[model samples]
Target chain A: MTVADVLLLALGAIAVGSGALVVTSTHLVRSGFYLVVSLGAIAGLYLVLGAELVAWVQVLVYVGAVVVLLLFAVMLTRAPIGPSADLDRPALPAAVIGAGVGLGLTALFVDAFRWTRFPSPDPGTAERLGEQIFGAWVLPFEVLSILLLSALVGAIVLSRPDIGARKAEDA
Target chain B: MPLWLDLLIRVAAVMAGFLVLPLVIGQAEHKVMAHMQGRVGPMYAGAFHGWAQLIADGVKFVQKEDITPRDADRTVFRLAPIVALFPYLVVILTIPLGPGLVAQSLDIGLFLVLAVLGIGVVAVLMSAWASANKYSLLGGVRGAAQLLAYELPLVLAAASVAMAAGTLSLPGIVEAWRPWWLIWQAPAAFIFFIAGLAEIRRPPFDMPIADSELVFGYMTEYTGLRFAFFLLAEYVGIVVIAALTTVLFLGGWHGPFEEQLGWLWTLLKIFALSFVIIWFRVSYPRLREDQLQRLCWLILVPLALAQLVLTAAVKSLL
Candidate 1:
């Protein structure tokens, strides 16, 4: 196998390994950190696939912003740094459902592709991606912004009970 | 030089530069700040101007006892300093000190630098969590908040420059300043410097490591050589940020007779920026945490975004 293939395999292994640890690790803060590793490895896989912009967005949004926020929440809540007995839950049902979903997706993908191969496309540079985004995908992108805006408003409302109380008094 | 030999020499130079540059900058900061405060700093060591003070400090740090708190997470505590230092080494590889002097010239060099720098947050978080001290935890939490807050403006500011230059490569950005520098984008450059101060956790944006409040912040529990690594990483970070500002705004290696002596010009700009950082530390008081966050989200973020849009518009028009 070539270097790219080897690197892909290594990254995939790290992603899967850390993902498993994220669920199983007893320490709350460590679980958040493991999630970072998993996301980082996934970003590495995106890089290996020659999607530099997507890979960096993954690092920036997922690994940098999302995971940091998660860790901040955990620390703010005074999460136990050591193993906590309460974290353990009944795993059989989760395992069964997870396995079924995983297998079904794998079967669907393999059956649909059926070992077909296509010519490799040109590397996706940021310029090309920008054109595609702003030219064709602009509507969906704008909609996504609105969605995020609403989510921000919702979050603010939820965090401040006084907003609802004031509105009720006004009514 | 042969290909392999050239590669080896570049690696060696970068390694040596990383190892030695921090000491020089640290010493310069001490001396400059002292002189500003009307006191002599490091006057005795090595006889000249306490030039050997950092050397002595290094020796002392190496010889001290490496202590771990009983409740500390030993593995992460040991790993944190290495993680902190890793990005500084990686970032220097992509920065061009002169024409054709960079160790690597990836197209996504700027993105890689910013992303790698983000990893330092993980190191801070890891050290803070592992220390298991209330002060350390408080520091780490502040670090997380500060990083998240400042990173938006920092990336947006850099994005404005990248848009103006039409390339993310450090060398390309430098070359784009054939006739003029991105300092023409004065507001963006100003936002970048301000946001960058927060990114490096320097004053007055040094809320994470507020010494008076948090007892050196997340580094409270660290001692000996491990502590030295943390300090080294901070100074190296200061140098890196200064170099980045020099490259992104002031024009990297662009000066009189720069064709033959470009690296010297780059060094001069980098040190000038470093001196400004020292000046900030000496002159400005640290901001309150809320004020720091508000300055980033309310002021800098909108300013940087507007600058980015303006840059894009100007680029398209031209």
Candidate 2:
């Protein structure tokens, strides 16, 4: 196998293994850290796939912001140093769902590509990605921004009860 | 030299810079702060104005007991220092000292640097939570909140410069820089420098580690080499922040004898900015937590947005 293929396989293995640890680890804070490892491995996979912008953004938004927030929340609450017995739940249903999803994705991928090798695309630099987004995907991009903006507004309103209280009182 | 030798030399040079420059900045801080406060600092260690004070400190840190609290999570507590220090090492690799002088240059060098730097927060959170100290946990939560708030303006201010330069590469941004940009990008530059200071948790933006209130904050539970690592990381952070401010705003490697002495110019600017950073520490007290948040969201964020718009307008015009 080519170096990229081998690297991809290794990173994928790490991602899957850490992802399993993220779900199965009884320690809440440790599970959050495992999620970080899983996400970081996925970013490595993106790097191996030659999507540098996506890889770094994945690290930035997910690892840097999302998981930090998750860890922050876990810490803000009771995060016992050792594993808590209360975290334990029936594993059978979770395993069944997980396996079904994994198998379905594998089957779909196999059905679609079936061992065919396609030429790799050029690396996705910021400039090229920008062109793609602004050139062909402008409408969807704009829609996404609007959606995010609304979500942001919703959050602000929810967080500050006084924001809409005065308006209602005036009415 | 062969390709391997060339790569080896570059890596060694970056590593040497990474290890040495932070100590230099630390010594500078000691001398500057001492002088500013009208006191003689570190006069005995090396007998030459304590040139070896940090080295002495290093030995002391190494000799001390490595203590992990009984209640602490051993694994995560042990892991924190490495997490704190590693990002700065990665960042230095991408920073260009001169034309073609970088150890490794990525197409998205600026983004990579910022992203990696953001990961440093996880270290603080990890240590704070793993220590199982109420003070450390409080400090960590404050740090997260502070970082989360300031991150917006920090990224936004950087985005302004990236927009102005029209490339996310650090070297490309320097190449795109002009003398007039010192005036044009001044606001964005100011925002960037201040926000960068906050990002690194320097004084006046140091609510998270307000030692007076939180007893070194997240670092309260740490001792020995781990504590020393945190200190080293802070100094390295200062170096990174100063270097970034130099590169992004002050026109890195852009001085007389442009071809030669380019790296010297970059170093000069970095040291100058580092001096200013120290001056800031000596001049201002730690900002209150609410004041810090208010300053970031109310002032810096709006100002960064305005600067971004100005950059866009100027870019469109030119």
Candidate 3:
């Protein structure tokens, strides 16, 4: 209907298509690359929805760090040159789960909004996002930081064989 | 002028800078490295101290045969060079040359720049995996590790500057920069510079492509024009790092007659920083990977965190 609507639809299609490819692709590395495309399209979707900060953060955190870590693990393990037959698994269960989730989400959103039109919100700049995080969402934000810190310490402990060895031996 | 024309001019300007500046830096590296080694670098290319050497190299690359290995993944291998090169071009677009001199300045320009620049790692990964070469894979993995490690400090240091300035926009940060910040933000600047060098895989941080060991790392399997693009991307990366350092840390466009001649000041700072980067390459041997990781995690990250605390304190006080 509108230019913004067109762009939104286009980006959504790209995101969904590439997301499907990410799961279905036989090549492990290619699947990772497809994930990049899917995440990037989601970033574009964020942009279309006027969440600039979230869009870039998506690119930075998801496409940049997370997927690279995924690819890194894949490369560290067996990354065959081409598609390996072993990557194939039973599709029926996965397809059922995927369809159910997709349909449930679609139904929930459709029921919630139900053809309502609302005024466009102001674009989410870094300042506004920061205020929201530190102001209203501060409690959950701090909890998330604590969770991340615990995970980090856990990782370090696991990685360092000597970290708890002496204490364990004494015990 | 219409909107399209204005956009066209900006795009054109960015493209010109993207094409020309890297060649200039490449030539400078050639001459600088040669002179530092007591040798004349390319005295015959453009007839005046080998000014055309990079141009000559470009021509040669263009004429060479592009090769994809038999074992390589065809699509990904071919796509790698473009992936390697595109982010620098995008990152350069948001960099402010002076007040109102940027191509397109977003409210979150600094964040966008960092985000786009981070994607360069994916290019390395793509190339490495697609090459199907042991050396390439090793190089890519090392590169990814190094980039990931340094990325924390890099973002932290930049975050300090953003906090100090109270703005996420490059131009606004420059406007906020005071002469005194040179001392106050010096530690963050140093950390940022070091982390940035590691990000671009420049020496002495260049373990990924340590020629003595890995044989050019992720780029081992690349040949001809594709290899040339990778080389160009490296030079362009140098330019991006230098420009960002100039903009973020060194008081961009803050020299004499800054209102009129600000772009010139920015360019001067960028070139000066680029020379230092080159000097670094010539001076230091490639770092051992363990030492590199240690320097990042043990040194730069903690220092950057301290700098952030200091910045917040200073900002609150001011």
DockQ of the candidate models in sequence: 0.59, 0.85, 0.87
Report every candidate's CA lDDT: 0.89, 0.92, 0.94
Q: Point out the higher-scoring one by lDDT: 2 or 3.
A: 3
TM-score of 3: 0.98
Give the per-residue lDDT of model 1 (tens digit) for B1-318: 799998998899999889888888999998999999999888998999899999999999999999999988888888999989998899999999999889888788899888878888888889999998999999999998999888888899898888888898899889887545444578888998888888889988888899999998889999999999999999999889999988888889998898989999999999999899999999999999889888988999999988988888888888
**TM-score for chain B of all predictions:** 0.98, 0.99, 0.99
* DockQ pick, better of 2 and 3: 3
In model 1, residue pairs whose N, Cα or C atoms come closer than 3 Å (at least 3 residues apart or on different chains), thus clashing, are none
Candidate 1 positional error at A12, Å: 0.7
Which CAPRI quality tier does the interface of model 3 achieve? high
Candidate 2: segments with Cα more than 4 A from true spot: A166-171
Candidate 3: residue B124 lDDT (0-100): 93
Give the TM-scores of the predictions, in the order they appear: 0.95, 0.98, 0.98
Per-residue alpha-carbon lDDT of candidate 2 for residues B143-237, written as tens digits (9 for 90 to 100): 98888777888889889989999999999999999989999899988998898899889998887788988998899989999999999999999
Give me the overall lDDT of model 2: 0.92
Cα deviation of A12, candidate 2, in Å: 0.8
Candidate 3 backbone collisions, by pair: none
